[model samples]
Target: MEYKWVVLTNTTLGVIMSSMNMYIVLISLPAIFRGLGINPFLPGEFVYLLWVLMGYSIVMATVLVTFGRISDMYGRARVYTWGFVVFTIASIFLSLIPSNSGNAGALLMILLRIVQAIGGGLLMVNSTALLTDAFPPSERGKALGLNQASFIVGSFLGLILGGMLVGYDWHMVFIVNVPFAVAGALWSVLKLRRTPGTGVVRLDLAGNVTLAAGLLAISLGLTYALMPYGNSQMGWTNPWVIASFPLGALMFVLFVLSERRAPAPLFNLSLFRVRPFSYGSIALFLNSLGRGAIMFLVVIWLQGIWLPLHGYPWESTPFWAGVYMIPMLVGTVIMAPVGGMLTDRYGARLFATLGMVIMALSLLALTILPYDFNLFEFELILFVSGLGGGLFSAPNTTAIMNSLRPQDRAAGNGMRQTFSSMGSTISMALFFSMLVTFFTMYVPNEISSAVASYGLPAQVASFLSSIPASGLLFAAFLGVDPASAIPQSVLSALPHSVVELLDSRTFLPSIIGPPFMDALRISLYISVALVLVGALFSWMRGGKFVYEESAGRPGEGRS
Candidate 1:
């Protein structure tokens, strides 16, 4: 392989491991909690679950821009190489955590994950800039396509790996990454050479601090809102959650002010003056907002409702859900490269706009499906959605990167990542809030009637009625057997036949499925609306533009 190819391969491996670790932890959460002797359904446990799932992404998003600027100041290759070492050490720590530390163990894991995110953020911020440096403008899209496809596939494969590993032992999920991380770190060290950074760089301490703190507060608040508060099904009304919004907003305003005053700002606001860069960013943000949480929604739908109803055991639902999702990954792999090549030849606008439209239609189609729809039909639509996402991702990213000058590409890419990450963070909050809203209104009454019909006393029935729908939804999310999660005292007092009826797989799904479907439809509708708006922004980007032609370009206005 050529030297550029070596760089691409090593960087691609880093992307794969980074993306894979994210989804693996998500799918393996149940087993991790089991291994730690924690019940995720319990009050404080949900908070731990939220932190484990959202903390890494939050840290990555917050640091990406700052790290990108740092890479530009120093050297992309140097930062990129160190990312591997940091990520490998974090993985070792995660896999070797002592088993008996309980909640303390969970907190330690979250802290270590933040370290991993710093490494991943550095890799991501530098990877695109490095590829752009190695390849000509005409070939940048193709390289990015392959890199993105690896990441998408890694995320999908993580689901399968997590399911398989957690079945035997949760520790396997972390341990599996050690060999790959070690190899990638060594390869990067020996084979990669540093690319010279832009000369005379000045650090923007104010911009970095304000932006990071603002984003952290916002993402943390939104993530915590997924858990139940004292009386509300959602924690949106919690004092801390309520405070985060204003605080984040104020900090962001200050960040903008600081950036404007800096000698050379952390974010070069001048880049947004490029029409393609501005519009493409808006489209990417909206597109990510619409699409980011779809995977989580699908996992809940499959693990909680479809799999169990279709005769899969609770313990096995996570694995089969991953198996069923294979078609989506296949679609992404097939579309990404083609889209990138086409964008290189023609233009990104058409492909990017059309992709969002297709994704919107897929969401609409999903909303109309019956709760127990045909498996083939479900897979087909999921494939369509993934195809649309893949088609959009490469070209949109190419357009944004190609619009910036060589020296500014790293920070530009970091800005792009910031929007993408913010969209994802907000998407989770939006979907969770919507689910809780509908579930709270409809599920409590249904549960009360279902338990009452099973010959339970009014007191026991009232207790069931009072249980928040958030708890029920989370129970389903974890693939918990609903009857088993009930208090042992109540179960002991009940008749044997009643206990058997409650314990049956049919019981919870039959009761919860309707309300769950209702909430799901609302969330899908929101997604459809968001993606259509993305298509509008994408279409308005107007014409092909590449920075290589900037000095004497036909579409100079677009650039």
Candidate 2:
């Protein structure tokens, strides 16, 4: 087999494996919490849940650029192979976590996930640079398209795979990655070779420190702001949250100053001067921000409202939610490679722009959907959204990589990946904040009215209504019946009819559905606006331009 094909195969495996880990744990959270002996509804336990969900992303966002620059200095292939080793080892440890370790176990899981994220960051930053190096400009898009497809497909597949594996054993979720990771690590080590002309360079310690610190502080702030403050729905006014933003901003300013003075900067600030690189990156960030939380929102909608209303049992909603989302995957799989091939022949701007426009329209359509939506109509919108994502991902990526010189590829791609990762993290924070705010304002009354209508005593109604909205959100997210958290004493004293009503699949879903839909519409509207703005940026990326072909020619870099 040719070396380029070797590079493509290995990199695609690495990409898929890394991306799959991001969502595998997501769908398996209920089982994972059970195995850890943790109750997710407790205020203290909510911190653990947030960390589990966001820790990997936070680490990935902060470390991507640093790893990219390191790869540039060392060798992309060499560093990438090590990534496989680190990721595999982390998976092994994660699977070996003691059953029912409680808080200790959850903390251990979070730490190990951060380790895995470091490995994932390395793989993500270098994969595109490796593909770009192995393939010619003409073929780069197709190769990148396939590679990008693996990432999207892997993310979606993780949900399905996690659902399957967790049913048998929660350990199997992490264990499944073992064989794949071991094989990929060995394959990459033996087959991949470092590119010639690459040489070691000094690391920009100062720039790296400031950038990492800045990103960490900001991410930490965003994550914690989802928690309730003293009397507020969210922690926006918490002293720690309030302090983090300004500290992060100061660090970013310091990072910029350090980069300006450094002989070899961690990030090449001058790269932004290239229109395609800058604008394509902006579009990528906005597009990611728009779409990041949609899956989570959809899952909550399915598990918390839709499936229950349709009479599915609470315990089964998680898996079925994954099953129902298959249409979106189908749409993406059909369009990603085709979009890439066409972009190679024509240019990235049109497909990329059109893709975002379609996404915006799809999201706008989603905003009008009633909570009790037709399944077919919901599936159709999801499919269209997938199509838009498929069309946008590869071509947009190709444009960014194509705009960079060989030496700058790792750093450029690193910066690009950072934008994408950070956007996703920030999107979750923003959208969840919106949902929680709405929940606080409306859920108590809704719950009180619904339970009272069932002829429950006023004290009982008040007790149920006093349950924190955040706790209910987490209960819904985990596919657990929210009524399960009520004290056994309270349940024993209730009339059998009231007890039955509380346990019924329809009761909670009915009460929460209207408020949930109200919050969802607001989120969808923001998503639509974000995607439309992303479309504008995508259009601004201009005509086809490949950096290698125009390196020595004046005015050739501008497309």
Candidate 3:
């Protein structure tokens, strides 16, 4: 194989490994908690869950720009090779953690995941830049398309693989990454050569600190807002959340100022001035924002409500949920490479715009579906949504890379990932808030009615009604039996028949389903609007444009 092929294969494998690790952890969370003997709903324990879920992405998003810049100043290949080593080490550590270790084990896993994120960030920053370096503008789209497709496919496989492996042992979820990482790392060391750094090597301390701190504060605040504060459904009013917003905003303001004055700026302002780069980035951000939450929401709906109602056991729903989501993966796999090929032949604007339109239409279709939707209809809509994502991701990425100078590609890709990572973070926060707000509003009535119908005491009914919707959501999301969420005292007081009725698989869904669907409808509507806006941005990015570097400026003579 050619050297470029070597790079592509190794980097693609890296994408597969890293992305697979991420989604496997996501789907395997219930198993992990079970193995650790941790109660996700316990006070302060939710924080651990949040950390496990979001910490890696948070760290990756926070440090990627700096790492990308460092790779530019040092050598992309060198940094990338080390990334594999670090990621593999982290995976091994995670897999080795003892089940009996309790909170210490959970904390260790989070810390190890942070280390893995650092590695993954390095891989992500350089992988596309390396491909851009290897391929010409005419073929860049296809190469990146294939790369993007691999990422999507990897994520999908993780869902299935998590189901399979976690059924045997939760540790297998992390353990699966080792062999692949080792193979990739060895290939990287043997086959990859260092590409020399461009210009002067300088690190911007002020810019780095401010950016990391700002993003961390903001992400933490958003994540914690899923918890209750006082009598409120969400902790948005909590002092910490309140204080984080202004503090994060102030830090970001300082970061911008520092970037403007720094001898070697962290982010290049001139890159944003380029029409395609700026608009393409914005479109990508919007697409990620619109699409991120919907993926998890679908999983939750399948695992928590739909599958259970259809006779799947609560503990078995995680695996089946992934199984049901296969259509989305299939659609992406089919479209991504084709979209890339088309973008290379034509321009990205039309294809990318059309993809977003399709996605919006799919969201609209989903909005009208009942909580227990027709399986075929649900799968069809999922396929369309996946197709749209596949169509947009690669071409948008290629366009962004094509519009940057060789030296700037690392930093440029970093900028792209930052937008994406931030989008995912914001999407989760937004989706959770939306779900909690509407569920809290309508679920009390639903619960009260159900309890009263079951002839439970008013005190028992009141207590159940007053329990925060967020807790119920977490319980469902974590695949806990709904009856398990009830206080033991309440369960003991209830008649045996009432207990059985309340504990039935369909009972929780009946209580929460209507409100969940109500919230989901609004969320889908918002997603439609967001993706349409994204399409508008994509259309405005103009024709296929490639940058050529000269005298430290890019795209100067290309047009």
How much lDDT does each candidate structure score? Answer: 0.80, 0.82, 0.81
Residue-level lDDT tens digits of model 3 in 166-275? 77888999989888889888988888878787645777889878988887888778767767778776687899998988999999999999999998777778799888
After TM-score superposition, the amount by which residue 255's alpha carbon in candidate 1 deviates from its true location, in angstroms, is: 2.2
Off by over 4 Å in 3: 43-47, 100-104, 198-200, 231-233, 487-490, 549-552, 557-559
How far in Å is the alpha carbon of 368 misplaced in model 2?
1.3
Worst 10 residues of 2 by lDDT: 550-559
RMSD of each: 2.4, 2.1, 2.1
Error of 1 at 289 (Å): 1.4
lDDT of 1 by residue, 139-180 (tens): 878988998899887888688998898888788888877777
Model 2: lDDT of residue 444: 88
Report clash pairs, candidate 1: none
Poorest lDDT segment (10 consecutive residues) of candidate 3: 550-559
Which pairs in model 2 have colliding backbones? none
Q: Is candidate 1 or candidate 3 better by lDDT?
A: 3
Segments of candidate 1 deviating more than 4 angstroms: 198-200, 226-233, 549-559
What's the lDDT for candidate 1?
Answer: 0.80
lDDT of 2 at 230: 84
Residues 403-501 of candidate 2: C-alpha lDDT, one tens digit per residue: 888878888898998888878877876687678778878998887787667777776666656566776777666656656777888778878887777
How would you order the candidates by lDDT, starting with the best? 2, 3, 1
